[model samples]
Target: MAVIDNIHERILATGIAEAGALLDRLGAPGDPLWPSPTWIPMRFDRPLAVGADGGHGPVRYHVTAYEPGRRVEFTFHPRIGLTGTHTAEILPHGPGSCVLRHRLVATSTGKMRLLWPALVRVCHDTVVEHLLDNAEHAVTGTVARPVRYPWRARLAVATESVRLRAVPVPENARLLKAALPHPDLADAYAVRVPPGTSLDPQTWADAIFRNPPPAVTALLRLRNALVAPFGIDRGDASAFDTVARTDRELLLGTDAGHLDFRASILVEPDDDGTTITLSTHATARNRSGRGYLAVVGLFHPPIVRAMARRAARAAVAPRPQASRKVSATR
Candidate 1:
């Protein structure tokens, strides 16, 4: 096996102990100073120490050595054809500064040599730049530039069309209309409930006003986990406000940073029941804004479905007796 080595270093204007501690915690889930979104958020199954086993996604590694407030190294087991050890260390550069260095030494014999240059190098360089930026920010309370996703890294996001079917609850339409301005529905997981089912309006109101269904909560978590790695900012649920509402339609708006977006839930009453349609509208300010919107567009469909389904189910499902009293006043 032939060997390939890469070394990257940065000088942080901080004490050795501080820099070392930060270096030690890199690649863990809760390290505030690590450049998490640069590549992907890395998570360890255990605490940072020798013998800990963890990595992000399919790239697995084991901690090989550790020196408190100084250095830590990992021997990686790549998903494909690479064997290596990567180390991060802090060395005193002066009275109150230190050099943080990362060294990657590996043997790549087969397809890994070709793959490394094509895929891994871009990711590696970005991660290193982020680490340095984060270190500098910790030492001095300023980040030189806000991190943006590289064009290459943007491949992590895929454009997907969203399709959702809204279930109607005609009996509870009146109840739902009364419960307007309830923003939590925007994040719920949807299930298509058929119309004409004997569902109590009060019960459905209680479910919506008081608490979300467990299935909806699970769906929200799944969605968050799916998109978090891509560095997508899912604006806070509380930020979703009722911008417009009427007897037949409701509009919820949220500040998505790059764009002003709204989710519209249109309800049409028919002889059989009501047909609900969940859709999204946005106005991007510029090209960057449009790009941001496009990235977020990948998630908009399923999320809208979740919101509509949750609202539909909550507006039709029977509320528990214990929560009925609480639902009546709200």
Candidate 2:
């Protein structure tokens, strides 16, 4: 079989959902392909019918589907040995945009394929060019919305009010605190510690404090390391308005059925280790086509003050020894 393989790429910007739907316009060039009317060179007359095996003409299409997100697959057979399938897939990157990938799985099945592969290469090139152009127009039509940061406050959760969640390392806490004035971050963190343990809150506190589980794509990786490990399908700490300040917390929501999902871990440093809080009031749409509160009560306040407390302890721990030295000197 002759393998004349050539691949070209491009990126198109469109809504995550719209990316796939736009392909409906160009459709497939399978069964019912029409000649381009002199009137419209750019547009096709009707939709294509990509069917099983081979179609009536020199080329045939067999459309097979295995979709997870924005993926569509269909194959074409010019002949027995010289046949191939085309795969088109789109993946959302951030907010309003996605990535589309198109690949041709071509193989030679006949004596002709073994004799001359150049002809096979030419055919593949012709079909791929048309598909690429269609993809470009599909994405160009839609405006790509700017990706935004996370929500800032509770009330503005849905309205694009993004709260600043720190995505830095604990090792940088001392450096970050020092940047703040006396009442600010640095020295305070160096001095203060949480109520228990040698752990200094301010100096060591980062917006994200922990990462749990070994999976590279686990929730800890997503939360940016702010919260602890949330068991699979469960938020680290779930919180609801069971009352004003705090109450019953359900990580997974009422409408969240059939699907096993995870939630965010909101926590605040108390005299104890940490208070994990999960929110139930907010709602967000998931990949499963269901809606639930994204988070109801997730919070991790600044801990520079906590570090200040620990630093104070370090100063006072040697008081008895200092007193004996004073008596000896007298």
Candidate 3:
């Protein structure tokens, strides 16, 4: 068994009552304390209270104790091989100030002992620091020095992104389904859209169209040049026409002499975060179209996956804060 104890704390200029109130709002919509959309959100089966069962991401835990406006404790689920408790508490500091602290105490057995130090610890440290930064930002409207992820943490996050799986085209993507009723080929990939980001499918589609992956752009140029001699129309972003749309889904397609294709962008809410699914459907118009489809299909999945990942990153990226202009006063 490997014993583990971790603690993260931030001194807030706000009073104990104010800091405690932040704790009370944990797992609530628009949660002001736990960093989200960028990180897995803290959630429970029901409203936060003693016995509330939920944990962010793969970790499982249940609330064991709760003191309104003061502290809360959670014990890790035994099945996860983490036997211990984690607590969030607000402690009074000096006048008009308090400390928001999160501490975790657990023992790891078997493979967890190896996984904990190698992978879990790095992610845990980064997450806890981000949580503290969120607490500070909530209390003071800004963090004095926000936590930045190191290279290792970035690598970990990238690894997770690469593991995203292909999912069936969402049933709610009615527009895309309607456009290609019997497509010869159909594929879909899904990625989680971080919380606190826009859920608008149009916004995501625009992001992808405006800024495609560099490799895909290069490949498209080469494809256009090669097919030019055959009098084939260039396959480019500009050629796509919007077929149908709603708040949750956007369908875009293009018709060519060889093949007709449609692409769907769908946004659906999930317990952990919002899911964005990108689906493709295509129909070959002739034998030549079948040949074209086979060639294009080889490259389609990766290119679509890359574009989807890029769009997700662009959506979550922090926009530059508008500069404030100060006027001179007499």
Candidate 4:
């Protein structure tokens, strides 16, 4: 297919092996850079290889080709007018250096002409830069340059609260309905993880939201501390309160005097890893509550996404320890 729009970026990295490893890691469910707060979360149904089926959000695709530690490409199944391939590749420079690149080439045949540029392209460009930023950090332990949104992108973000709209819950959310009888508003986010993770749904929920990792805890504390000067109150170590719990799902709640929030994490096991979805709903009972809701909407998407990403990361792997021991080799 002829290429309609494509983005190519190359960044120097410390080691070929490391860069290649990072390329593979980028496809994992827990990748920190992916599923950006403002972008769709991505995953593969099975191990990275040809024929694996998966894609981000509503966009679905099948892996067309794969080369371990070197590259992977996908051919979309036609969503709207989006067709063609998106590939992530690693080009080694020498034993000690390499270049990491991501290229998306596709043609929009229908409504995509309107959707692709206005929506996908804008977000894709920013997301690629972010991926590179993450790659540099993973390969060299330092970012050559920090990722920054252009002024237009920044404006889009500031107004995203207006553009953001909730999509219907997936079939797996049947459990959530039993808990949230009448949700004023509902939204959900999900990602695929490695199969057979020992952590159960409830256990993972507790660790991710109820008890955050040490690093996240410290960061939250620092944020709260900074807000203290402005006389703003902060939640305790347990950022949320559990309203209800069952074997496969846990409902968490938060009360903001005027506004009330309820969210849950439902774990659905599959042949591949578990698919974890963070679903949430908010209610406003009074005029003051309605006012609060209006303000909260502006930042709700990113906030919920950040929480989901943190939980997804924890669900797939154990949290890293703060201290590490270095052994002396004889």
Best by lDDT: 3
Off by over 4 Å in 1: 143-150, 156-330
lDDT for 85 (candidate 2): 66
Indicate the residue-level lDDT of 169 in model 4. 66
Model 4 TM: 0.50
lDDT of 4 by residue, 202-269 (tens): 66566567655566556667756764554334657443667677677777777665556777777777
lDDT of 1 by residue, 40-73 (tens): 3466767888888876545678899989889889
Global lDDT of model 2: 0.34
Question: Between candidates 1 and 3, which one is better according to lDDT?
Answer: 3
lDDT per residue, candidate 2, 1-330, as tens digits?
Answer: 445344533355667577666544333332111111100111222343333332222344555664544665666656555466666677667766666666766766666465334443433343344344445544563222211211221112111111122332233223222222121111111222122222222222222122112332253346545323332243332211111111211122222321322222233444312322221122223432222122312221233222223333332221121111111000
Q: What tens digits encode model 3's per-residue C-alpha lDDT throughout 1-330?
A: 557888878788999888888899898887887766656678899988999999876789999999988999999998887899999999989998988888999998767778888888777777777777777767666666666666666665554422356888778878888888898889999887656767888887887766898998898899999887765678876555576899899998888988888889888876557888888889988887887788888998888888888877656543211231211110
Q: Estimate the TM-score of every prediction.
A: 0.50, 0.31, 0.87, 0.50
For model 4 the local lDDT of residue 45 reads 79
**Model 2 CA deviation exceeding 4 Å by range:** 1-8, 25-57, 66-69, 76-78, 111-116, 141-330
After superposition, candidate 4 runs with Cα above 4 Å error: 32-38, 150-330
Residue 4, candidate 1: how far off, in angstroms? 2.2
lDDT scores in order: 0.55, 0.34, 0.78, 0.62
